[model samples]
Target: MNDVQIRTFQVPGARLHYEVRGTGPLLLMIPGAPADAGALAGLAACLSDRYTVVTYDQRGLSRSVLTEPPADQDVAVFSDDAHRLLAALGDEPAYVLGNSGGALTALDLAARHPERVRALVVHEPPLPELLPDRERWRAVFQDVYDTYRDQGAGMAMGRFIATVEGDGAAPPAMPDPSQMPPEALEMMGRIQGNLDHFLAHVLLPVLRFEPDIAALRSGPVPVTVGVGAASGDGVPALSARVLAERLGVEPLVFPGDHQGLATDAATGAEIIHKTLA
Candidate 1:
């Protein structure tokens, strides 16, 4: 395993906590809301031998502390935060991969600062606006946000999870907690603690973001949309397929479900390696 170097960068409204490992070209892995750098540590380790992998806690998530009170998050702000982090890291463009809500951030980053990104892989970006069933999803997400405000995070998260899990005909294939390593357990605990903040401030804004399709299409940066083979025809997979169509590219299939990179890092890493190769 490569020695992980933890660092911090001062952004406009918050201090960002980041981790760096491996040695080669830069590969920045962006995690979705409520998840910190540890969420992507397994994926990073798999890619470390070939590339310098960077993962960070977005503002108000985990060690990335806010200078002011938490409020509704913005995709542009998130992208700008990523922009500054890349600018500070080096002049060369970095390979960027953003998963779930983080994919929204990556889209905005590539649109706004294409010069900073060598290439981008958007893994199941939940852009309802891009989907054929936009209105339905919009109502669903609004209800989730409303539930957070009125009923609290527990109820809101239940609705959110149910929507993401699709049909719900079968129990979700989840890893047994008792067998997970200490670091994995700690990461799970941190994510649970972040739920309130995520549901209240992060979730809705991300789902509501309108990607700059025109800009992304004409930009210099190459973009690849990815979906998990096991994600089925859920909103995430469908949304990714729509985005790929708009971009004139086919959706890349990887291992596992929505959380593929974390659960099947080796296979996911190989797919990413070949895609960027």
Candidate 2:
């Protein structure tokens, strides 16, 4: 068993909260929007034996405190943050994994600073530029934002989750806010406070911006696009396929849907370990 040590890195505007566990090559895992380091705890525990697993709360979320509120969440800024964190770890090029928006950041990092990354596994990155229905999703994401502003957090989050699941099945009925467990309530609070920030700053900007395909293709680092087997050909899964096609590499299928790392950590870790090895 490895001890989890919490540390803080003072980047320009944010003091990022990161954890280091296990011992070996560093594997940095970035969580999706609205999820923090806690989201990666299970996966980190599973992989820590063979690799030094690291996870962090993105700026303005969880314990990663920011000096000022950012008006727009730029992928480049997020990538730079990842780059600085890797530099802080040492000269070794770290293995990186990003789920959803984190995947977008990973792609950005590989595109700009290929030397800092050894192998990047991007699982379910939502790149609008690659999809033919970019306009439709643009409207869908915007509706989520509108729900946040016009309706409220509960409604907005419901829509956001529904849109991402993209299972064609109708979303499950939202439980009464009052009957929820303590953790559920707490998460809702976090979502309520952060959803506006995420929609206004991160969501639209990241999906709309195109990653440097030419740079990724020519870079020295290895990039693996991962898709969840259980996630039907949703937008994110399709995005992964398109990215793999562009890179001329096959997509790695994991056990569960977008939240596989949290749901089925052991299997997800094994697949990732083999891929990196």
What tens-digit string does per-residue lDDT give for candidate 2 at 182-213?
Answer: 75567556655666667767777777868889
State which candidate has the highest lDDT.
1
Ten-residue stretch with the least lDDT total in model 2: 183-192
Using TM-score as the measure, the top candidate is 1
User: How many clashing residue pairs are found in candidate 2?
Assistant: 0
lDDT (Cα) of model 2: 0.84
In candidate 2, which residue pairs get closer than 3 Å at backbone N, Cα or C atoms, i.e. clash?
none
Q: Mind sharing the TM-score for model 2?
A: 0.91
**Against the true structure, what is every candidate's RMSD?**
1.3, 2.7
**TM, every model:** 0.96, 0.91
Identify the runs in model 1 with alpha carbons over 4 angstroms from their true place: 169-171
Candidate 1 global CA lDDT score: 0.89
